[model samples]
Target chain A: MLATMLYGPGDIRCEEVSEAKILHPTDAIIKLSASCICGSDLWPYRGANEVTAPMAMGHEYCGIVVEVGSAVKTVKPGQFVVGSFCLSDNTCPHCRFGFQSSCEQREFMTGAQAPYARVPLADGSLVATAELPSDDLIPSLLAVSDVLGTGWYAADAAGVTEGSTAVVVGDGAVGLMGVLAAKQMGAARIIAMSRHKSRQDLALEFGATDIVSERGEAGIARVKELTNGVGAESVLECVGMEESMSQAINCARPGGKIGFVGVPHGVTFDGQQLFFQQKSLLGGPAPVRRYLPYLMDLVLDREINPGKVFDLELPLADVAEGYRAMDERRAIKTLLRF
Target chain B: MLATMLYGPGDIRCEEVSEAKILHPTDAIIKLSASCICGSDLWPYRGANEVTAPMAMGHEYCGIVVEVGSAVKTVKPGQFVVGSFCLSDNTCPHCRFGFQSSCEQREFMTGAQAPYARVPLADGSLVATAELPSDDLIPSLLAVSDVLGTGWYAADAAGVTEGSTAVVVGDGAVGLMGVLAAKQMGAARIIAMSRHKSRQDLALEFGATDIVSERGEAGIARVKELTNGVGAESVLECVGMEESMSQAINCARPGGKIGFVGVPHGVTFDGQQLFFQQKSLLGGPAPVRRYLPYLMDLVLDREINPGKVFDLELPLADVAEGYRAMDERRAIKTLLRF
Candidate 1:
């Protein structure tokens, strides 16, 4: 099987790798139909994260179950399924509380950007639809496995509601999908902060009521002006950086909530300022498994078409091109078809 | 009227000052029955926070209404009342949403250390019992105005619940009250991080299951060891320093919540670490106005005896002695009688 491997920073290659099989009683072997490059992947690619060794890449994927272990009762061969970035034993206390990402028996289920991948805790981690999804829905379902689910978590964390005025910081695929999530959650006003023209346009199409081209202080001012000087009721921080986190805090009204989905790089809390302001920060690695089922339904129902984030596509053998496109900012997200 | 004022760091004086009166249409003048020194006052006394001018001090008090402006409807002359440190117009959107401290039309109502103080937005700011409280309840009602309310906010923000374990990071009046709050909120276990014998005793009486005398990493380790190596489910940070804040974060479970009511001095957020940990942070100045009503009811019923926090007492003319007691660590909190 051909799989993507990270040898070092900015060094991605598609090479022959051992095929995956059911290694555990709860495992399921998936023949991936679609997978994509993630915004988080760029972290290591840009040398922001240290990659010590050649590691199996990719975590976002949707596929058909090729094989299933005897203990995997819910998932079976020939079924179309979507799985979370992280695997979880659904029966754990944390998983029962809807924090599957922090499941006690959690496992990092990767190697999705390959022809086949092994999924652990299959019964609790994989969700299957009634029928095989059409080719057009594949990419959207693929997104549900990670990005779309994460976007939903961001909106939920931000407390986006029917009449909430929300600000989304970042213009990556997850940020763009956050606009859609907020819209779906009934937010009346969705402001997407983006300087990239392509991402900004997508944000508008995804139900962003307004777009702020500025960053930092100026962007916060524009958000306040858009919100009639009260700032947004909820802010979804999709970019995890000091500047972006500060901007999110500045753009929220006192007592408002900031839902951060971005993997934070360097951020600090000013206890006094936060105390006086009354703002709340909530979010971390999203529990994608918690939203996979519902997001798959949304994809199937055509309620949201997050697949549009895939501006470039390639065969599994050309996975390196997908990474290159995203790295060069030539693609919002790159889809790889098996 | 005699009042306490801060001339500079470690320079507190109790002397005759201008009498307070109804300054706004919605204001009411209250002749204080009791006032208390707060833990936060130590910030300036210790020279941690710069004190600029000789400003009237004290933010916690309970009193009898002496006079009311034409617009004061809910509170009338001769009524006994307890109000928050922040004066807020209840009619504003922020106030309506329960964030009264950030109300659009707000006034900083201070000078509670004096015999008389002005209460802003009296109609919405003051909560009264059926009858004027007996002397026994005066101290308890005084607690309702600030420390008790703040403690409740910290517990609420931390998401303390039945069977949940909590870690309290301060040993002041508010921190002791936080133990009470967590216990009332059904926290099964509470670890009070304190080195003070008096506070530790008070925490035990308030339902703390354990006490940790260590600070920072060692304290966090103690909390984790006590919680089966998973850390507490909720962390109440009542101290505003960076070290205390970091300790709170380190003492919580991966998916736990940190409710910090401390006035943050300097704190930084490491995005990558926070994102990976899945912890949530919430809190600020505290919506004391939001909690005053319920807390007042508890005080009326004698369900909580928060007044025990005051270990020293003085007349308004000798309010400076009360400050000295607290500044010298001779008292957990000090009360002033009119």
Candidate 2:
């Protein structure tokens, strides 16, 4: 089986890898239908996050179960499914509380950008769709494995609700999906922070009522201008850099909420700012398993087109081109066909 | 009039200062009926937070309206009242959203530990009880001015509810007040983190169902053990130190909430831990004015005796001793009578 591997910074290869096999009684082998390059992947690619060794890459996928261990009951062979980046034993107390990503027995899924992937704790991590999704729906369903669910978690953590004014502080695929989540959560106004025309257009299509192209202080000013100088009621911080996080905090009104989904890098929260500013902050991994079933329904019902984030699609063999497209900003997200 | 002045580290004095006067149309002169030393006041006294020159100390007070500016409408001469540390204009959007402490025209109240205090934005900052209270009620009413309101804000921010298990970090007056707030909010179990016998007793008296004498990791373990290894749903971080904050985070369930009210000192939020930990953090200067009216009624009805936290009482001339007692841990809280 061919899989994506990151040998070092700026080095991605699609090489033949051994086929995945069920390694535990609760594990299953999945043949991926689709996978994608993640915004977080850019970290290792840019050499900002260390890649100590040639590690198998990718943590997002929607697939068909090829084989399952005896203990895997919820999903079986030939079933189409979506699973979270974090494999979870759904029966854990944390999982029962809707925080599957932090489940007591958790394993991280990797090497998903491949012909086949092994998933542990399959019953909890994988959600089986009621019916086989159409080809068009596969990309959107694949998003539920990570980005879309992550964005949805950002909106949920931000407390988006009826008549809310939400500010999304990134223009990446997750940010666009955050706009979708805010819209679905009934926000009256969705503001997407983006400078690029392509991402802005997609943001508008995803329900962003406004776009602020400015980056730092100016970006904060634009949000304040749109929000009557009070800032948005809920802010979804999709970029985890210090500047973006600061902008997200500044763009929320006092007593407002900030839902941060980006994997933070060199970000240290200033206690004084948070205290004097009076903003509530909540976020973490998307706990995608918790929202997979619901998001799958939305994809199947055509209520949301998360797949729109995938502006570039390529065969698994051309995976490096997909990474380049995303890295060079030519694509919001790149989908890889298995 | 005499006011408490912080000259430098370990240098506190009660000296003659200019009498309080209404400098703004919205100002009112308050003849302090009762004032107390706060945990935050110790910051400058210990020289941790920079205290430049001589500055008037104290921001918590319950008093009588000695006089009011021409524009003062809600409060009048001779009314018994209590004001929050932060004066606010009630009409601002932030105030309308229940964050009076962050009101657009917010003013910090100082010199409350004096014969009188000039309260700006009096209408919004001060809450007048129905009638003059007896001497016994003064201390309790004074608690409403800060500690009690702050504690209530902590519980409110933590999302404490009936049957919820709440862990309160710190055993100071404010944290004990937090225990009281959690109890009043109907928490089925209230855990107070403390090592001192006096503070622990006071905590129990104020509604602490359990006391964890340990600190740091051991404390977190105790909380986990008590919560069936799941941790509490609501964690009130009343101490702003890194250790206490970290413990508060660790003692909460994966998706639990934390309400922090302590004036933060030397604290920087590690973004990675917060992201992976999945905790909601909300706090700052407590919007005491927003909770004053309700908290006052509870105090008046004898449902909660928040004033019991004042373990030491002294004449205003002995203000230096008051600070000394708190600094030396001889008293949990010291009430200074003008």
Candidate 3:
């Protein structure tokens, strides 16, 4: 099997590797219909996150189950399924509370860029479709596994509601998806902060009512100007850098909500400053398992075209090019076929 | 007129000062029925906050309006009224959204520890009673102006609801008021983290179902034990110090809300740590004005006895002693009368 691995900074490789195998009774093997490079993958590839060793790459995936452990109940072999980037024993208290990402037995998915991936806690993590989906919907189904689910969670956490205004801080794939989610949630205004024309066009296609090309203070000022000088009611902080976080916080009115999805690196917040801002904040890994079923149905029904986010596609052997394209900003997202 | 002033750390004085006069057209002069020392006063008195000048010390009051500027419309001279510690133009977008403390023209009431004080933005700041009640309810009505209102805002921001579990992270006057607020909001279990026997008793009387005397990790562990290893859904962080804020965050479930009202001094949060903890945070000066009317009605109706929080009483000339008693923890709260 050929799998993706990160050797070091800017060193993504595709080479022959041992096949993924179930190591626990709750695990299952899935031959991925498709896989993609996540915005998060750039963390180690760009050297933001230390590459301590050759790390197994990829967390977003969806495909047909080729094998399942005896203990797996809900999902079985030959069934099509989509799972969250976070693996959880979905029966835990946190899982029951709709925060599967914080489940007691949680583990993050890895080596998912390969053709076959081993999924742990299969019964609780994987949502099986009733029947095999058409080949055309695989890209969208793969997105529901993580990217789309995360964007939807951002909107839900931000408390976006009918006739409300929303501001998206990043123009990445997740930010574009957030615009779509906010639109689906009935937000009257969706503002995407993007400096690039291609991403801006995609944002508009995904229902962004306005685009602010400025960054930092200027970006916030533009958002406030568009929102009647009151700022937005809901803000989705899709980028986790210090400047982006500050911009997202400032773009919301008092009592407004900020739902941050990007993982923070060196960001720190002053308690007094945040208190004076008087904004509500809720952020963490998205509990994609909680939304997996509904989101997959949306894809199966062809109600949404999240697949459009993938502007670049490559074969599994050329995985290095996929990472390079996204890292260099030449691709919004890259879909890989086996 | 006798007033309280903080000259420096450990130096509180009761001195004869010039009487308060209207400085703005929206101002009103009120003869305080009662004035009390607050937990926040200790911040400057203890030098946590820099006190560069002789600071007028008190923010809680209920009194009879002695005079009103020509522009004051809602409140008139000779009426009994209570105003929030935060003066806000209630028509602003933030105030209209129930975050009056962040109103466009927000101001903090000052010189409130005097026999007579000038309240700015009177029409929007003061909530007047239809008629004056017996003197027996004066203390409770005064509590509504700030303490009780603040506590209610903490509970409201933490999303307390019927049958929900709540954990209070402070045992000060405001924290005790939070217990009362949680009770009124129908929390099935109210846990108060307090080591003092007297404060714990007061918390129980105010409707705390449990009391954890431990401070840090042990206190969080105690709360977890009580909740069957699952933390409370709502946590009220009434103390703003680093230790208390961390305890409040640790005492909540992943999806729980932490509403912090204590004025944060040197608190800073690492974005990565807070993200992994997955707790929702919303903190600020309590929008006391938003809850003032409802809290005042409760006091007037005698449905709640928030005045019980004031354990010591003294005359205006003994204002220094009042501050000393509260500073030394000799009294839960001290009420000064003219």
Candidate 4:
């Protein structure tokens, strides 16, 4: 099997790796159909997050199951499936309560940008479609594994609903998906903070009502202006930087809700502002598994086209180029076909 | 009129101040029936919070309407009323959405430890009871004005429901009231964290299932131990200190909710832990006005006794003593009777 491996910052390689086998009775082997680079993956590639030794990369994928352990009952071989970044048991107290990301037996998926991979907790993690999706729809279905599901989680956590005025921070793939999620959920207005022309177009296509190119205080001022000097009812903080976090908080109305799904970096919040300003903040690794069914349906039914985020696509052997394209901002996301 | 005024840190005096009168068409002059010192007041009294010059004290009280501006129609002379620390125009979007403390036209209440108070936004801030209550109920009714109301907001914000395991971080008057609020809301197990025997007794009396005297890490560990290593379902952070805030977040089970009503001081959260831990945190000033009506019914029907928090009572002339008692820890709360 060939998989993408991260040796160090700026060093990505696609080479032959050990064959995938059933690690446990609950594990299943997946023949990767499509996998993509994520903004979060950039953290380790840029050396911001510590990466010791070479490790398998890619935590997002949609694939067909080639083999399954005896213990895997729900998901079976020969099924097209999508799974969350977090492999959950789905029966733990946390999973039962709808927080699969924090499942008691949760495991992070890696080495997914490969020809084959082992998926543990198959019964709980993998969701099978009625049939294999068309090749054109594979990219969108693949996004449901992480980015799209994360965006949906952000909107759900922010309490975005019909008539809700939503503010989306960051113009990355996840941020664009957040716009789509808010739109699908019936948000009356979605103000996307985007500066890039390409992302701005995608944001608008994803259903952004307005776009604010400004950053920092000016960005917040623009959102406030759009919200009648109050601010958005629900704010999605899709970027994890401190500046992005602060902007999201400031962009919400007093007593408004903020849903943050970014993998925070150097982010710290003033407790006084959160308490006195009455901006409710909720964030973390998204519970994407909980929303997979709903989002998969949306993707399969063509209600949403998240695959547009994959502006660059390459063969699995060119995985190194995929990382570079995203790292250099040459692509919003790069999908690797196996 | 005589009022409690703060000249600086550790300097308080009962002195004659400007007379209270209806200052605006929406204002009502109330003859204060009862007033109390709050934990927040101690911040300024102890020099923790700056007090630049002599300022009127006492932001919590229940009083009798003595006069009203022509615009004040709902509240008239002779009616007893309770008001939150924040005077809101209940008609604002935030207030209409049930967040009166964050009302756009909100004003902080001050100078209530005097013989009279000028209640602004009278129609929205003042909740008139059916009639004058008996002497014994006066203290409890006064609690409804702030402490009890604040505690109730904490529980409500934390999403407490039947069978919830509630952990209160503070053991002060508000924390005790939170225990009572949890009880009234049908929480299955209420855990009050306190080191003081007096407060522990009050907590047990208020329906606490267990008392964890440990503070900080030990306190969080104790809570986890009691909840089958899962932590509590709902955590009420009644104290605004960093240690208490962190404890509350750590004490909540994964995906659990935290309602913090404490005025945060020098508290900053580690964004990474909050992001990956999947804990939902929301805090700010309590929207006490929204709960006033429902709570008033509970107090009037003798369903709750929040006034038990008043451990010391002094005449209005001995206002300085009232502040001293709470400052010296000789009382959990001090009531200044006018």
Candidate 5:
């Protein structure tokens, strides 16, 4: 089977790899329908993260259960399903509490940017729809595996609700989707901070009430101005840089909540300032599995077209080019069809 | 009137100062019945926080209303009241949402160690009991102004529940009171980490289920051992330092919450680690005014005796000695009788 492999920074290749099999009783073999690159993937691609061996790439995916292990009961062969980036047994205390990302018995469902992948803890990690989704809807379902789910968690953590003024502090695919999540959660005002025309348009289409082109302090000032000098009630930080984190904190009203789903890069907490502001920071690796079922419903119902984030598409063989397009900021997001 | 003043770090003096009067229309003058030094007061006294001018000492007290300005309606002369260290109008959206510490109309109450001090936002900052309690209960009532209220906020923010296990980092008055607050909040097990005999005894008396004398990594190891290697469900960080903050984060279970109320001296946030842990950090300057009423009721009902933290006492004229006692670690807390 052909799989995407990361050899080092700026070194991505699609090569024939050993076939995947159901090694564990709780595992299942999945034939990929669609997968995409994540913003987090950029870290390793940019050489920001240490990459030792050429590891299988991609964790976001939706596929058909080609084969199921003996212990896999809930997910059967021939069913269409979406699995979380982080696979979990779901029965563990952490998973039961909706923290699947931190489940004691968990595995990373990687190598999805390929023809086939092995999904562990299939019975608890994979969620199936009543019927297989059309090929056109595959991208959206694939999103549920990671980006969409993470965006949803960001909104949830920020306590976004009806009449909530939400400020999304990033313009990446996840940030645009966060605008959608905040809108679906009943946010009255959604501010998307973006300087890029493509993402700005997507954000507007996804329900951003305003846009702030400014980046750090100026961006915060613009948000405060839009919020009557009080700042937004809820802030979703999708960029994991120090500047972005500070913008999120500075753009929230005193006592407001900042739900940051971005993989924080270089940020430090200034205790005195955070304390005096009375703000709360709640987020980490998103419990994507916990929101997959509901998000899949939203996709199935066509309530939202999140798959539009995939502005560029390519065949699985051109997966390396897809990574290049995103790395160069030429495409908002790239969807690889297998 | 005599008031305590800090000329500089390690230099405290109690001397005659002008009597406080209603400076603003919303101000009320209070004749202090009892006051105490807070753990935060030691920050400046220990030279951790610089004191430039001859700053007035103390921010916690319970007093009798001596005079009220024309705008002060809810509180009148001769009413015994408990005012928060942070005097807030409690009418802004932030205060309305129960974050009085960040109230838009906030004016910090200063010189609480003085015989008389001016209290701002009298209507919202001061909460009077049904009537003045007996003299014996004065110390406990004084605590409601800061330390007790802060501890309660810590427990509340950490989401301590009836069956939850709590770990308190720091052995100061607020940390010890956090043990009491966690117990009051129905925590099943309270682990108070302290090496001080006086504080450990107080913690045990306050319903600590275990005592871990180790600090940092060793302390976190002990906490994990106590909780079957899962860490505590709730952690209260009452010491604002890098090591203490890290210990609090390490001691919390995945998906757990850390409530920090200590004035953070120097702490930075490691975004990547925090993200993977799924831990929530909630706290800032506590909204003491929001908790004073309930805390006063608890004290009135004799359900808690927070005043036990104060091990040293002196007349208002000897306020300097009180500072020295706490700074020298000879006293857990100091009380100034007026």
Candidate 6:
């Protein structure tokens, strides 16, 4: 099997590696239908996050189960399934509360960029489809595993409701999906903040009612202007940087909600400032497993086309090029084929 | 008229001051039935908050309308009313959204410890009862103006619901009110974190199901033990210091909410730490104006006895002693009479 690994800054490699195998009774082996490079992958590649050792590359995945340990009960051989980036025993208290990302037995998925990957806690982490889906739905199903589920969580956390206004602070793939989720949630106004033409076009396609190209104070001003100076009721902070977080906070009216999904690096908040701002904030790794079932149904039913976010696709062997395309802003996302 | 003033830290005095007068068309002059010292007033008295000038000492009050400006329409002479410490134009979008503290023309009420005080935005900030209530309800009605309203806001912001568990972080008058509010909201269990026996008794009287005397990690652990190792669904952070805030956050489960009403002083949050903690955060000055009418009715009906929080009663001439008692923790709160 060929798997993607990162040796150091800007050094992503695809080389022959041992096949993924079940190491625990709760584990299952799945042959990936598709995989992708997440924006977070750029952290270590850019030297922002430490690359202490050769790190396994992908977390987003969807595939068919080829083998299962005896203890795995829900998913079995020949079944199609999608799982979250954050693995968890869904029966835990946190999981039952719909915060699977913080489940007591939580673990993060890894090495999914390869043709085969081992999924732990298979019965609890994987949601199997009733029947095999058409080949055309693979990309969309893969998306429900993380990207689409995350965006949906962001919208849900923001408290977007019918006839309410929403502001998305990033124009990444997740941000575009956030626009779609807000639209589905019946938000009357969806504003996407982006400077790039391609991303803006995609945002509009995903139901963004307005686009603000400005970045800092100007961006906030434009959003306020669009909202008639009262700011949006819900704000989705898809980028975790300090500036983006500040923008997200400022773009909401008092008593509004901010759902941040980005992994923060060096962000810090003054308690007095946040108190005066008076906005509701809830951010963390999206409990993708909680939304997996409903989102997969949406994908399978063809009600949404989240796969449109994959503007670039490549073979597993060209994994490094895929990372480069997204790192260099040449692609919104890169879908890798086995 | 004699009014309380803080010349500097530990320099509180009761001195003759000019009579209150309407300075704006929206103002109303009220003859206070009673006024009280607030825990927040201790902020500047203890030098935690800067005191650069002689500051009027109180913000909690309820009284009969003595006079009204020409433009004042809702309130008039002879009507008994309760006004929030935060004055707001209720017609603004923020106020309409139920966040009166963030109203566009927001102002903080001052000189409230005096026998007569002018209230700005009278029509919007003051909620008048149909008839004058009996003297027995005066203290409770005064509590609604700030302390009770603030505690209720904390519970509301934390999303206290039927059968939910709640943890209150402070044991001051406001936190005591939070216990009452959580009880009214039907929380299955209410935990008051306090080490004082007197405060604990009041907490139990106000519907606290549990009292955790430990501070810091031990306190959080006790709360967890009581909740079956699953933290409370809602936490009311009534103490604005960093330690209390941290304790409040740690005392909640993932996806739990922390509604903080205490004015934060010199507190900061590491973005990444908060992100991984995975709890919802919403804090600010309580929008007491939004809860004023309902809370006032509860007080008038005697369904609740919030006035019990006022453990000390003093003549207005002894305002300095009242401050000293509260500052030294000798009294939970002080009621001042004209």
Best by DockQ: 6
Tens digit per residue, CA lDDT, model 3, B186-285: 9999999999999999999999999999989999999999998989999999989999999999999998999989888789999989888888999998
Encode model 6's per-residue lDDT on B178-282: one tens digit a residue: 999999999999999999999999999999999999999999999999988989889999999999999999999999999999989978998888888999999
Q: For candidate 3, what TM-score does chain B get against the true chain B?
A: 0.99
Q: Which 10-residue window of candidate 2 chain A scores lowest in summed lDDT?
A: A268-277
Off by over 4 Å in 6: none
DockQ of each: 0.57, 0.84, 0.88, 0.77, 0.70, 0.88
Q: How much lDDT does each candidate structure score?
A: 0.87, 0.91, 0.92, 0.90, 0.89, 0.93
Q: Where does model 3 exceed 4 Å of error?
A: none
Q: What is the per-residue lDDT of model 5 for residues B111-210, given as tens digits with 9 covering 90 to 100?
A: 8888888888999999988887999899899988989899989998898999899999999899998999999999999999999998899999998999
Per-residue lDDT tens digits for candidate 1, residues A1-338, read 88999989989999999999878899999999988899999988888889999989999878899999988899889999999998998777678778899888888777888989999899999999899989889989998888888888999988899988999999999999899999999999999999999999999999999999998789989998888788888999998888998899989888788889988776766556667777888878788988888889889999899999889989888887788888888899999987
Model 4: CA > 4 A from native? none
Tens-place lDDT per residue, model 5, A4-28, is 9999999999999999998988889
lDDT of 3 by residue, A52-79 (tens): 8899899998999999888888888899
Model 2, B176-249: lDDT tens digits are 99999999889999999999999999889888899999999999999999988999989999988888888999
lDDT at B174, model 6: 91
The weakest ten consecutive residues by lDDT in model 2 chain B span B263-272
Comparing 2 with 3 on DockQ, the higher-scoring candidate is 3
Q: What is candidate 6's lDDT per residue for A1-338, written digit by digit as tens? A: 89999999999999888989989999999999999999889889999999999998899988999999989999889999999999999999999999999999999999999999999989889999999989999999998888888899899999999999999999999999999999989999999999999999999998999999998999999999998899999999998899999999999999999999988878999998999899999999999999998888888888999999999999999999999999999999999998
* lDDT, candidate 1, at B139: 92
Q: What lDDT score is found at residue B102 in candidate 3?
A: 94
lDDT of 4 by residue, B46-71 (tens): 88888888888888878889999988
Model 5 stretches with alpha carbons more than 4 Å out: none
Clashing pairs in 4: A284-B275
